[model samples]
Target: MKARNRTIQLVILAVIALIGLFTIVSNLSAGPAKYPQVGDKAPDFALAGLDGATHKLSELKGKTVILNFWGTYCEPCKREMPALQRQYDKWKAQGVEYVGSNIGENAITVRGFLDQYKLTLPVWLDQDQAVRKQYGVSEYPTTFFIAPDGRIAKKQVGEMNDAFIESALAELVKK
Candidate 1:
């Protein structure tokens, strides 16, 4: 009887091990998930800014807004900050707004990075990471060009220069 009990225990253990191995293998076979596509309604989000105020995507509904998702640690993001700043300076007078959403970073760190780079654009801190997930931003630097009607005009997956920004802005900005 004891031998039969030991045999049953061993079989159960083996089955559990097999189940675990199968789960791991299945997970490994699954590839990376794809992000959201263009033409989708830009997800509404509210995040605390570096200035201690909160910013919501729904609040800025009338004007063309550029939503840039970036992190300080991303080299490409740091590289493009200057160009973005220049574009913002030139077009801000024309009622274009550029917002940089810092993903998964503390406000202090983001503030320091902005100060170091002398970036004056409004930055929203997505510390909770909910907005990042909402926007389907798996990468470091993704940009969404929002039209005056609050729909996504264009989706840029990587770094953008002043010319690229200007071109995108020109399409959305009304004359």
Candidate 2:
């Protein structure tokens, strides 16, 4: 009886091991994730803004779009908001679109932050963080500079200076 039980247990364990191995092999066969890179078409997403509008990225095609993924809790993000607003002020009339995506924060908190900073840039609420994952954003203040033709001109991973933004904007807006 003991030998029979042992044999059954061994068979079950072997089956489990084989299943695990198969899963691993199957996962390995799947290719790596492809995120939007510079020159690739930026993925389109529609998210509600703090301004009570559902902003869609595809609709902003033919204009240079600054899609910034930020979090209210991130200090670096906070540091850059003013600079972004300044650039927006300077460039909006020239056909630049600003899409500020606040990741995983409630409207009230985001509102308070924006208010406290006196920043006028329109912020899109990424309440569920779906757009963050779509953009493969692992950090705060990841900014994508999309060209007038809807291609990604640059992907900035951290806090941006006024100078860097100005230069990128120049490249983006050049005739």
Candidate 3:
């Protein structure tokens, strides 16, 4: 009886080990997942604004769209807001849409941040971070310069300056 019990336990352990091995092997075979890259079609997303209005990325097709993914906690992002606002003011009338995609933040928090910064740029609230994930934004202040044709012209990760933003806009317009 003792021998039989030991055998049963060994069999169960072997089965569990085999299952774990199989799972690992299957996952390894699946390969790395793909993220958005430059030259890819900008993924479309619809998110609400702080004012309770829904904005869709597709609606801005045929316009140069600057999608800045930012969070309230990121200092670099905070530092770049004024430059973005300046560029937005300068180019908004020229069919350029600069949108701040506030990642994983509530309307109240976003509202407070905007008020503190005195920023008037249009901001979309990405409450669930779905838009961020879609855009492959792994860092704070990842800016995507999408061309008028909806292709990603450039993916600027981290904070951006006025010159960089202006040059990117120029490139988008040239293409």
Candidate 4:
């Protein structure tokens, strides 16, 4: 009986080790990490907008893109929406594109929030959080400022104030 119990314990340990090894190998073979650093070219992703239009990061090559990841339920995201909208409105004529990505939410939910706030910032759906995971967003309101050349100029986690938003845009548009 003692030998049998020892064998069972060994078998369990071996199974756990195999699982860990498999996980490590799987991550290694999954290609480069999608978490892009500052000055690195932002990873390209395509998401559907409310109007059923596809918005792709790579397609906005010559325009400074503000890629914001947010959820409707987040209060900070709600508070900063106006500031983001203002900057987007103020700088869009100068070739600044704002891609408001709603993480893990359906269109109806996002539409309701948009209607409640009367927001005009073109929001895209990140259903299943594929884009969220790709961008390595662990916070509710993470913003990525992509330069006109497609390189990430800055990445901001947490809520941003109006001045910070303006400053980032000022730099992005000037480049």
Candidate 5:
């Protein structure tokens, strides 16, 4: 009788372990899905920039906007800043707005990074990852091309060179 009870206890423990593993696996894989697809309306979000200024997505309406999500620790995110800055400078007068969402960093750290890179584009600090979740961004250096009508014209992931950036901007600028 004791042996049978011990066997039952072991079986219950194994079942519990399996259930825990399944829950963990499912949670790790689950996340907010991507939404900045082409032709979709650019999702609106509000956050504090590195300069202590609040920016709302809806405020930049009637202009072409490039919404980029990046982080301080991401190598590719750092790599694309220079090109993005250059693009911002070139077409800024042509009605292009460049907004950056910094994930996983505080305002001071992000401001230092912006200063270090001489990036003049406005960067919003997403310290709590709320904006990132709202945008459904899963990776660093994800960019959305928002048109003058507030539609997402394009969505780019990973590091992109000046040519690709310029091409996307050119398409959005015509509006």
Candidate 6:
């Protein structure tokens, strides 16, 4: 009787181990999620701005769009804002849309940062960071240069300078 009980316990443990192994195998087989790369279609998202305006990526299809994912706490993101502003100023007249997507921040905080920087570029708040994750923004300042046709021309993963921004814009518009 004791031997039979031990045998049953061993069988139950083996069943649980098999289930765990199956789950692990299934997850491993699923592989990693794919992020948007250069030449891929930019993932579209509709997020609200500080002014209470909803900006949709698909709606800006006809214009070259610069999607900048940033956070107020990141020094590199702050450092690149002026360069972005300069580029925006240079290209705004030509219908270039620079969308600054603030990741996981409140309106007051973002508004204060913008005011402090004196940046007038259109700012969108990703309060839940859904848009940031959709864009696969692992870093603080990841900039995606989307061409007029809605294709990603370049993915700048760090702080950008005026020259790099200009070159990216030039390449984006060339499409």
The TM-score leader among the candidates is: 2
Q: lDDT at 75 for candidate 4?
A: 94
Model 4 misplaced stretches (Cα beyond 4 Å): 1-34
Writing each residue's lDDT as its tens digit, candidate 5 over 1-175 gives 9999999999999999999999999988787565566898988888887767888999999989999999879999899889999999999999899988888787788878888887787888887888888878898889988999999888898998899999999877875
| lDDT for each residue of candidate 6 in 1-175, tens digit (9 for 90 to 100) | 9999999999999999999999999999789877889999998899998899898989999899999999999999999999999999998887799999999898999989889989898899998999888878898899999889899988888999999999888876665
Q: Which stretches of candidate 6 lie over 4 Å from their true place?
A: 1-31
> What lDDT does candidate 6 reach at residue 55?
81
RMSD of each: 9.3, 8.6, 8.6, 9.3, 10.0, 7.9
lDDT of 1 by residue, 129-148 (tens): 88888788888799999888
Candidate 3 residue lDDT tens string, 1-175: 9999999999999999999999999999789766778999998889998768898999999999999999889999999999999988888888899889998888888888889889888889898998888777889989988999999889988889999999988777766
User: In candidate 4, how many Å is residue 33 off?
Assistant: 3.5
Backbone clash total for model 4 is: 0
TM-score of each: 0.77, 0.82, 0.80, 0.80, 0.78, 0.81
| Error in Å for residue 155 of model 4 | 0.4
Candidate 3 yields a Cα-based lDDT of: 0.89
Query: For candidate 1, what is the lDDT?
Result: 0.87
lDDT of 4 by residue, 1-175 (tens): 9999999999999999999999999989898765888999999999999889998889989999999999999999999999998888888899999999999888999999999999888899998899899888999899999998899999999999889989999977776
Better of 1 and 4 by TM-score: 4
The prediction achieving the highest lDDT against the true structure is: 2
Clash pairs detected, candidate 2: none
Query: What are the Cα lDDT values of the candidates?
Result: 0.87, 0.92, 0.89, 0.91, 0.88, 0.90
How many angstroms is residue 103 displaced in model 3 relative to the true structure, after the best TM-score fit? 0.9
Q: Which candidate model has the greater lDDT, 3 or 6?
A: 6
Could you give me the TM-score of model 4 versus the true structure?
Answer: 0.80
Question: By lDDT, is 1 or 6 better?
Answer: 6
Q: Residue 93 in model 2: shift from native, Å?
A: 0.9
How do the residues 64-167 of candidate 2 rate in per-residue lDDT, one tens digit apiece? 99999998889999998889999999999999999999998999998898898898888899989999998899988899999989999999999998999999
